[model samples]
Target: AEIGKGFLLPSASISSKTKEQMPAIPKEIERAEEEGVKILYLTLPTEITGKNGRVNGLKCVPLVLDEIDAEGRRKPLPISASEFLLK
Candidate 1:
């Protein structure tokens, strides 16, 4: 399984640059869906110093080079996000 981090932020309290750095959750979900993945797990850090308990940063998604896609593009399988958060 792959592992990574994700950040969360309040609606109007985070910087634009920080927001830009965050990964697109919808895209991740989409990619997983395309693969026929049965489960999607996410880890949300409980304690954060900025923006009143909201997250503002995320680690890069851990991907495994499993195979090539229909377009001759290498596809990666991501680790479960739940494992990290529950810990």
Candidate 2:
């Protein structure tokens, strides 16, 4: 489980992704203070890449929901988008 989330563990990390990669991210870092998130590192998901360098999506669910052994991480219900990083 520790290895699975290794990429996000660093304090100051740099990731390279365009809007095409993950539509969730902002396109430009115009003002560092303007955006709420202070990015530390970049993480590359295990997915196929197209010629355009865009992610083709994951083949599997990554980990089976039933296989999750961490009790704290095992959410009884789906999490809201706002509190996603907290848990």
Candidate 3:
């Protein structure tokens, strides 16, 4: 992931099990910038089973398409699923 105005990118391999790119909400990003967090690591959540001891990757439903109007206009829409993977 890239951060800061210079867009310093991280060199890390995301697992294939990762479903989607975790989005940084504008508000949170602004706050992080204001707080002087030039580089931030966002950890995603993983699914656990049984006694919640073992992790089984992450479950996610990607946002396919944004809602459209009859005139083929786009509208501001929120993300659908909240699935994530912590690594």
Error of 1 at 54 (Å): 6.9
Candidate 1 least-lDDT 10 residues = 9-18
Each model's backbone clash number: 2, 2, 0
Q: Candidate 1, residues 1-87: lDDT per residue as tens digits?
A: 022213232222121222223355767645654544423232223333335676544433334444667888554455456322211
TM-score of 1: 0.26
Better of 1 and 2 by TM-score: 1
Give each model a TM-score.
Answer: 0.26, 0.17, 0.23
lDDT of 2: 0.31
RMSD list, candidates in order = 14.7, 14.7, 10.9
Name the TM-score of candidate 2.
0.17
Tens digits of per-residue lDDT for model 2, 1-87: 223345653222223333233334344442332433444222322334354776433221112122335564322232123221211
Weakest lDDT window of 10 consecutive positions for candidate 2? 78-87
Give the alpha carbon lDDT tens digit for every residue of 1-87 in model 3: 234446443223222221233264667655754655533233222353333675534442223334578989543332456455422
Instruction: Please tell me which predicted candidate would have the highest lDDT against the true structure.
Output: 3
Candidate 1 wrongly placed segments (more than 4 Å): 1-60, 81-87
